[model samples]
Target: MYGYIKGVVKKVYPSHVIVENNGIGYLIISPNPYEYKLDDEAIFYTYLHVREDVFSLYGFKSEKILNLFLKLISVSGIGPKSALGIVAFDDTDRIVQAIELGDVKYLTKFPGVGTKSAQQIILDLKGKLIDDEVEIKLISDAGKDVEAALVSLGYNKADIKRVMKHINVDQSADQALKEALAYLLK
Candidate 1:
């Protein structure tokens, strides 16, 4: 029910952070908790998870990433931990790339993912992400071309725009387009 939390960081560990809002300290689990520092004023996109025996807060730096995490956890075989691992290692683009490429090997590298889960991720999430929202770090030559080809192939302009945004100019346009399309399609 919480939209976001603004607070001073009380402590930071490798996998968790404590943020003080008002007089209370909230222990939040995150993919890269170490990226934050003590005493810093920070805003965390939060997910409050309540179960019979546990209540936990999972936090992320951006709302986009947090939405992706929520989507990941909705898959049948994926859990919060697996979703966090995916976010930890892959940005929005890369995860979409892995899904578009049907590269189970790359996906399985994340903690707690295996062959079955990887396949499930691909099956469940393919074509489900908003093309404009996928974020990736590296755009290969192949990726560029694919994106352009998709535009030429009669895909939606918004789709092309979103895909193009993630492409790195250093990559050949054709290849970057391809990778972008892969992410977009995913």
Candidate 2:
């Protein structure tokens, strides 16, 4: 039960990082491995997943992400990998609010989460998440749909996010799309 590890980063893969401590290198999977650089010192909160065939260690940049990952894996259909995906969703407060509010549509935006799994997430974790009161300004179903549409039309999500800051109040997915594109092109 490795609760945490502090070491110098040896190598960083897209999905994992190798940290060296006490003459040994430990490979730890992280949601965003690029956050840790080679030869940099870091303390990663960790969880060890044990199974019949394999054992793996997952590291998180923060306790909130680690806790969220644990909660995600507790769901019936979610494994550690899927849970990691959910944790990688980038906004812990928004995700917790979505689950607390039973927003399946929002959950589906996470990688590896489908409709059935989204609903299962709502059923299994509703009211169990920490209510962090993060102003979830526009992560609604409509907002996510619009974002997806923009991505399909060749806009990157990060660029869309920058443009979205100029969008006005909530609108239907279609209306949001038009407004978003208008702002983006400007």
Top lDDT prediction, candidate number? 2
Q: Write the residue-wise lDDT of candidate 2 on 46-151 in tens digits.
A: 9999999988999998888899889989999899999898887667878877775567888898889999999999888865664335233436688778777888
Question: Scored by CA lDDT, what does every candidate get?
Answer: 0.80, 0.82
lDDT score for residue 136 of model 1: 32
- TM-scores of all predicted structures: 0.74, 0.70
State, as a TM-score between 0 and 1, how close model 1 is to the true structure: 0.74
- Please give me the total number of clashing residue pairs in predicted model 2: 0
Error of 2 at 155 (Å): 48
lDDT of 1 by residue, 1-186 (tens): 887889999999888999999999989998999889889999999998888999889999999899889988989989898999999987877787777656799999999999999999988876566454544323455555565577678988666655655555455666566566578778
- Give the lowest summed-lDDT range of ten residues in model 2: 130-139
Error of 2 at 107 (Å): 0.7
- Candidate 1 wrongly placed segments (more than 4 Å): 132-186
